[model samples]
Target: MSLVDFSSDAFIVAFFLYCFGFLFYGVAIIGRKFSNRNPDEHMHKWGRIAFITSVLGFIAHLTFFFTRWAGGGHIPTSNMYEFMTFLAMMVMLAFIVVYAIYRKPMLGFFTLPLTVIIVAFAAVFPQEVQPLIPPLQSIWLKVHVTTAALGEAFFAVGFAAGLMYLLRVVDFNSKEKSMRIQQRWVEFTLYVVVIIIAFIGSVFAFRGMGYEAHFIQETVEISSQGVESTTTDDVKYSMPPIVKPYNSQVQSMDSFLGMKEPLFETPSWMKGVDAARKLNTIVWSIINGTILYGLIRLVLRRRIGAAIHSVMDGVDPEDLDEISYRAIAIGYPIFTLGALIFAMIWAYIAWSRFWGWDPKEVWALITWLYYTAYLHLRLSRGWHGKKSAWIAVIGFVVVMFTLIGVNLVLVGLHSYAGV
Candidate 1:
């Protein structure tokens, strides 16, 4: 089998193994709370096992990635498959680092399932081999995608950590805070797992089938004379229009960096549609996925909501609010630099415009403004807790929109992505 196929097999195996390991770790947590066993005993033993398994999975995934890279001689982040793999790798690496620092395995409860879902989606849309498009051939492609994914992973960690903080603080007023805490963990795990499954299932069920174009035969008057009539029937398939290369090679910023023609042909019919659609799909997927998952969890854990409110009765919501800020403080600037400023700089060099307010560009700016407002709310208005967490969460939504929404829905220079 080709290395790509091998990589797919390895990834599937590794993901399943990780899932099993995650299940055990969840049991370990529950075993401590209910079994009257030493929580530390299980925490130390099973946490180590979970860590080791995740590490092994990471190594296997890396091997698959490296093998593909060696065989393909191209960076792996260029397509959906590679992007998901790359994202999982980054989240794993970040989680491991955080685990080492906090010595807390609870983060795994949130992070692992997320990684699994992303990998699962990656598998759903298997990687296909295609030559690198000219725009993706730059060394900056590696730097940009890598840094951006890393930034996103950190933001994800922040989200997980923030949620943990909320869970911990929520039960402060409870008569049995310690007792309820364990149950909270269980509920959180169940909720996350259910949400991921529901999302994947929903996407599978609702994914749009490609369109079918049909032609109908009809008779119409062909002339001013009443007797003259003609019958015509024409059918055309909804094929993307073909766009030929501008030349044998694209103009390069440096003479030493000779121009190379794009590997894939741009569809002429989609002169301005593809990129917008692609960006929109990305944005909508994130928003809809989060909303769907959140609603599902809310429905499943209706009683837990009341329990959570009771727990938070005496806790400082302000601290809960500020935790998200810590995440945003780190994530927002990095996101801006990677997703916007740096991208625009690259665009200027290639397309000769620093900012064109294209759909993607405009959405990015909107995301930037959203975070800017978030910071303003935190600093100027002294917001914290529920309000702040809400803002932080919304900020992520904006980021998602900038990253995926604009690329999919709005037509512009980026229309090449077949959004």
Candidate 2:
């Protein structure tokens, strides 16, 4: 096979290896009770095996990265698919570093699943290598994207540990108002995770079934000279449309589950062809996520968080909190250098400005400031355990919005990064 084709195959291998690594970690944790050997010995043996598998997966992922870079004539991080995969790989690297330090089997149980989810999410975007745009052609693209993603990977590890901290300490049996509030918020977080998984699953399912729809969207633009210009573009959907683009007509739409057309038109205020598609995707994700979450609830007859909390029984909340804090502390400076410093340097080169209030730039600043506050509160306010864990979790949410949400919802210099 060509190197590019080989790289694709290697990526598939890496993905399966990561999935197996997750399953093995699950076995290391959950199968201890079933084993005839001493529980500690069983967990130690299986955790070692799981860690080895994860290391092999990381190697394969690295092979994919370098091979694709060689074959595609650019670093494999110029698009959403490439960047997410690189982020997943860096998460694995960060996990390896932390796991080596702690030797905690439960960390693998949480981190591997996270790595798997991220890899799967990366697959949702187009994978074909494309030439970088003019703005992305500089050496700073490699420097900025890789370093920023590496820093975010540490944050992702912190998120896993923080989530584990919650599952470890939160009382599922408590009837107190405060505990109930905590339970609800934890459940909501799990629901959001399930929504992401559901969205990925739904995308792949419809893709496998070859579902598609098409539309012609007319965009009206006004020039500085007050000249009105109209442009029409073709928009395609891989899933059935629940909402058609505003002020656009259907070119052709395949019937789906007895539905022949969109149920509604996108609100006029939501401009761009992508806006309607993105809103439609959100609607589908929510619908499918609710159904999937309902099925899980039916099976367990308990909240998903409670179910997970049961497995967290022997894990220490204090250690998890410490790991979360350490991971974020390590990442914070790297993020400052990459997402802020290198970014401004590149912005100076590309846009001839050190700072501009672009939506992406604004959100990047928001994320940085939020994390800065996180560190401040953590150091000065003595926020430990649950408070620290919650901040870590919420901080990752802010990071994700800066990375993904800005691209999807707002148009700016970073719009090209969105799929």
Which window of ten consecutive residues has the lowest lDDT sum in model 1?
Answer: 239-248
The residue pairs that clash in candidate 2, if any, are none
Candidate No. with top TM-score: 2
Look at candidate 2 and tell me the lDDT of residue 87: 93
| Model 1 Cα lDDT, one tens digit per residue, 4-38 | 77877777777976786687667655555655667
TM-score of each: 0.66, 0.97
Model 2, span 303-332: residue lDDT tens: 999998888778878899999999999888
* Model 2 lowest lDDT segment of ten: 308-317
Clashes of each: 27, 0
Candidate models: Cα lDDT each: 0.60, 0.91
> Model 1's lDDT to the true fold?
0.60
* After superposition, candidate 2 runs with Cα above 4 Å error: 219-230
